[model samples]
Target: MSAPKPIRSIVIVGGGTAGWMAAAALSRLVRTGVSVTLVESDAIATIGVGEATIPPIRNFNGLLGIDENDFLSKTQGTIKLGIDFIDWTREGHRYTHPFGEFGFDIEGVKFHHYWRKLYAEGKASWIEDYNLCATAQKLGRYTTPVADPASVLSRLTYAYQFDASLYAAYLRAYAEARGVVRTEGKVVDVLLRSEDGHVDAIALEGDRRITGELFIDCTGFRGLLIKGALKTGFESWKHWLQCDRAWAVPSANPGREITPYTRSTARRAGWQWRIPLQHRVGNGYVYCSDDISDDEAAATLMANLDGEPLRDPMLIRFEAGRRKLAWNRNVVALGLASGFVEPLESTSIHMIQTGVSKLMALLPDRDFSPVERDEYNRQTQIQMEQVRDFVILHYHANERTDGDLWRRVREMDIPETLQRKIDLFRNRGRFFRYDDELFADSSWIAVLLGQNVMPAGWDSLADAVDPALVRQRLDRIREVFRRAAEAMPRHEDWLARNCPAPTASVTRKTA
Candidate 1:
């Protein structure tokens, strides 16, 4: 048996979040005989409108040894406790998909079941009354969770809203300082090996050619190598998710308190997002072109801004699906090149981060074993599919009767995965997390109940105790959470005292 060849040079085609993220991960984790190189054109721009994110991003940064304060200061970032969903069920209805557990499980039963039992008896308050994240958000408060499990502060979980462009630059410095070479030019042609049709090298201007044993594709939407060269097809998800166009714009800070959450307001044909950053607020209207024109979308976005526009809305068109195989042959696709769900749940950047994480885990030798590639593709498919289900939930479980889009989605057929979850929750208030799904039970509960999908029955155990005792227990828990939330510092005050961005940055050189 011959020894497998070692991979030496890795070429990342394109830049922005995905390419730089790949560079950053390889620069930190790659073992013997491997080096990372990234090629991006100075003329090309990034789809940096992906500003909101989930909590795992903090872990991603921590793994790279990124100090929290430094990251926030550099990226114009802000804390996010959850997403504020408005008018999702119907007009004038609002709910928060918070990041933490609700009222800590009581005894052996989930808290929601107990709460549900009370609510059925007209003894419970709104769902938010049990969540610290929701309470803190309502009061404009923010605090990092403490380490002690017994403490009220320990339940808090968080994410962030940031300027994606600055984040890419921040990571660029991190990767470059670790010896990842950067080439500045666009690929004029992709050369494939005659024997296997594998990408061998890419041609740039000035007649220069750069070759590598492995290639990473981060060229947003273009799929320059994976789909364009390898002919790996895409699995279109437009049927389930029909909203395909977005108009993104930045707005001046409204000189008001920055809420510690992202807000998504349902529109006639789609939804508009509000992401508050330290320096500005990012706003966008994502709508289906079948129902609204580009000009109408842009005008809708502009009209909805809370402050003056920073720049004209940038209209971006996208399809909702992923590549058939994120890793094909010698090339692996990352970020938008691999696939995209609309920025509805703010999964864009997280998708890029997860792809890079999976790539590092499946680092292959020069032989590029098909087994590893298939596993990587399989996991990627599951992750994308899981997220697709969650995103579709927001659209499918709606009660809005004002628009045809809503009506269509409400009646649309969803994946069996989501259907099963929804069915379980509806049948008996049982929400279970399967296959390490991204959205936890609390998240599902928040959405299901907020959308008015009440369970027919809760866990039978809720009846084990006297109903009056259950109400008293829930009341005590809710009161403690409310007091704890009220005591936390305001998000703005916390930012100013802890990690405010400097008014000016020259080169962003770390001391």
Candidate 2:
């Protein structure tokens, strides 16, 4: 047997958040004499509506040695504790899917179990009352989580809301500074090797060619190399997801206190997202073209802005699914080229981050072993399916009677994986996390209860804890969270003091 040769060069195609993120992360390889090059055309536009993220983004930035405050200021970013879902369960109802856990577990059992028993006895409040992040978000407050495990504030977790284009630009600077070469040209053709059909080179306009041992496709939905040349197919989940179009626009800041959370309002045909940044608010209406026309979707978005529109609504079209194989032969696809599952839960940017992390973990040699590629694809598939099921839950579990879209989704069948979780929770508020699932037990509990999916019974284990003790502990947790939220600075004030953007013109408003 011969020793495997190490990969010498990596070529990344495209330059939005995905391309730049891959380039930035892989730039570390330059230290080992491996060349990393990214090709993107200045003329190409990116689908930059992925302005919201989950908490894992903090880890990604930390890995890159980025200062949180500096990155926030540069990207006109604002903290996001969670999402406020409006009218998803039914009209005139609202709930929050907070980032952190609910009250601490009692006697090694989940907190929700005890809360359920208390609620049944009319002695408990909403689940959000016991969560620090949700309480702070409701009060328009902001604070970093404390490191001490004994502190109640230590339970808080958060992500960020920012201008996606600015974030990509920030990452581009970071990658370039780390010696990643950026080429400004559109790939016209993908040349392949005759013997193995592996990507050999990419030909840009004016006959420029760039070659690499490994190729990464970040070419958005076109999949220029992964699909266009390699013929890797996509697995569509439109039957379950349904929403296929969106109209995204930016709006001027309303000069109100910037809430430290994202808001998702349920519309007739789809949903509307409102993400607050330091400089402006990013707004969008994601809808199914079959249920609503583009003009109607755009009109709905325009009519609902908190401030004047900053630009004409840009239309985006997409289906919900993943590539059949994220890694195929010598090429790996990230971002839209890899797959898209809508941005309902703000998972788009996180998906890219996960892809970059996985590629780095399973990076192949010049020989391109099938073992490495298979493991990468397997993990990618599981993650994508998990996300798909989670997103579908938002739609499938809705109780709104105003629109056909909601009614249809509610009656439609969901994946067994999600159905199993729903069944388990509905039975006794029992929930379990799957292998490396992105959403934790807290997230599942939040959304499930938020949508009015009440369990038929309380956990038998929770019955072991005395009712009086449960009530006392729950009340104390609520009071502590309330006081902590009150003591924190207002979100807008915190931004002004810690990381105000140069373009920000914030106006304080009483919360």
Q: What is the C-alpha RMSD of each candidate to the true structure, in Å?
A: 3.4, 0.9
Which lDDT tens digits does candidate 1 get at residues 316-388?
Answer: 9999999999999999999999999888788888888888888888888888889889999999999999999
Query: What does candidate 1 score in Cα RMSD to the true structure?
Result: 3.4
C-alpha lDDT of residue 511 in model 1: 12
Give the least accurate 10-residue stretch of model 2, judged by summed lDDT. 502-511
State each model's CA lDDT, in order. Answer: 0.88, 0.93
lDDT value, residue 335 of candidate 2: 94
TM-score per candidate: 0.97, 0.99
Off by over 4 Å in 1: 1-4, 29-31, 504-511
Each model's backbone clash number: 0, 0
- After superposition, the stretches of candidate 2 with alpha carbons farther than 4 Å from their true spots are none
